[model samples]
Target: MARPNSSPKASISPQKKNSSSPREADFDIQQELSRLQEVIYESFHIPVSRWTIIDEDKVLEQLEFIGTKIPEAIRKALQVLEQKQEILANAEAYAQRIIQQAQEEAAEILDESGIIQQAQHEANQIRQQVQSECEAIQAQTMAEIEQQRQMANGEVEQIYRKSVSEAQQIQEGADEYADAVLTRLEQELGEMLGVVRNGRQQLYNHSAQRQTNNSGKQLSEG
Candidate 1:
C-alpha cells in the first residue's frame, strides 16, 4: 500500500469567452428583433380576457438590452452617413472646379475672338481711310491741272503730259501703300490665329492631363 503514491490530477478551469464586438452586437440585435417578432406572432391569445400571454419579463429584458445598444448602433449609422456626405461634398467640389475651369477657358476663347474681330475692324477702317485719302489726292490733282490748262493755253500739251505723269505717280504710290497695308494686316491676322491655336492646344493638353489624373485616382480607389 505504501509502495506507490497516487499522482494528483490537476484541475483545469474553463477559459472565459471573449465578449462580442460592436459588429457582433449589431448582429445580435437583428437576431433578437426577429425572435421577438416570432414570439409575438406565436403568443397565446386569451379570448376571454382579450389579453395575450407571453414571456413579458423576458421580452422586456430583451427590449431593454436592445434599447441600450440602439444609441451605439445609431451613432455608427450616423458615422457612415457622415462619411457618405463627405464623399458627396468632395465630388461636388471637384465638379465645381471643373465647371470653373471650363468657364475660364470659354472666357479666354471669347476674348481671343473679340480681339480678332477688333483687329479685322481696324484693318477695314485703315483700308477705307487710305482709299478716301487716295481719292482726295486724285481730285485735288485733277483740279490743279484744269486750272493750269485754263491759265496757260499756249503750253497745254506740255502741261497735259506733266499732269498725266503726276497722276500716274500718285496712282502708283496709292497702290504701293495699299499693298503694304494689306500685307501687314495679313501677317498680323496670321500671328493672331497662331496664338489662338496654341492656346487651344494647351487647354486640350491640360484637360487630358486632368482626365488621366482622375482615371488614376478611380483605379486606385477601386
Candidate 2:
C-alpha cells in the first residue's frame, strides 16, 4: 500500500527552529576579549622582584581561542550595519518612486487644454499634497535611521563598558591574590632567617666554650 504524503511543515528541520535569530547571534567581541584578559590575570603568579610568572603556553592558547571568536563577532556586527544601510536605501528608493509618480500625475492634470484654471488649481493642490507626503516620508525615514543608529551605538557602548568593568574586576582579583601570596612568602622568609640566626648563635657559643676548656687544660698542665 502507498503511504500518505507528509505535510510541508513536518518536513522542516528541527535544528532550524532551535537556531538563534540574527540579533541573538550578534555577540559582544569586547566581552570575549575581557574574558581572555581575566583568564590571563587569574593565571598569573605573584611577582618575584619585579617579575610575574604565568603559564605562557596556556595564555597563548586562550588568546588563540579569543582570536578565533573575534572575527565572528565582528562579522555579525558588520552584517547588522549592512542590514541597516539596506533598509535606509530601500526606504529612500520607495520615497523617490512615490514622488516621481505624484509629479507625473500633476503634469498630466496641467496638460489638459480645456478648463485651464481648474487644471492649474488641481495641479497646485496635487503638488502641495505630494510635497507634504514627501516631507512626511523623509522625516519618518530619517527618524527610523536615527533610531537604529542610536541603538547600535548604545549596544556597542554597553559592551565596551561591561568589558571595562570585567577587566577591572579581574585586575583587582589578581592584585589581591598576588598580595596574599607575597605576604605569605615574606612571613615564611622571615621565619627562615630567624632560624638561621639562632643556629649561628648556638654554634658561636659552643665554639667559645671549647676554646675556654682548651685554655684551662693548658694552664693546669703548665
Residue-wise C-alpha lDDT for candidate 2, range 1-222, written one tens digit per residue? 122222222322222122344423644544445544554444534443333455667667757766565545544544443343344344445544544554464345434333334434543554455446445645664564455446554465444334444435534543454354345434543553454456557767999999999999999999
Please list all clashing residue pairs in model 1, or write none if there are none: none
lDDT of 1 by residue, 74-184 (tens): 444333323432333343344344434534544566464544454445445544554555456556645654565464445423443354455456556545655554465
* TM agreement with the true structure for every prediction: 0.37, 0.36
The prediction achieving the highest lDDT against the true structure is 1
Superposed Cα RMSD, model 1: 44.3
TM-score of 1: 0.37
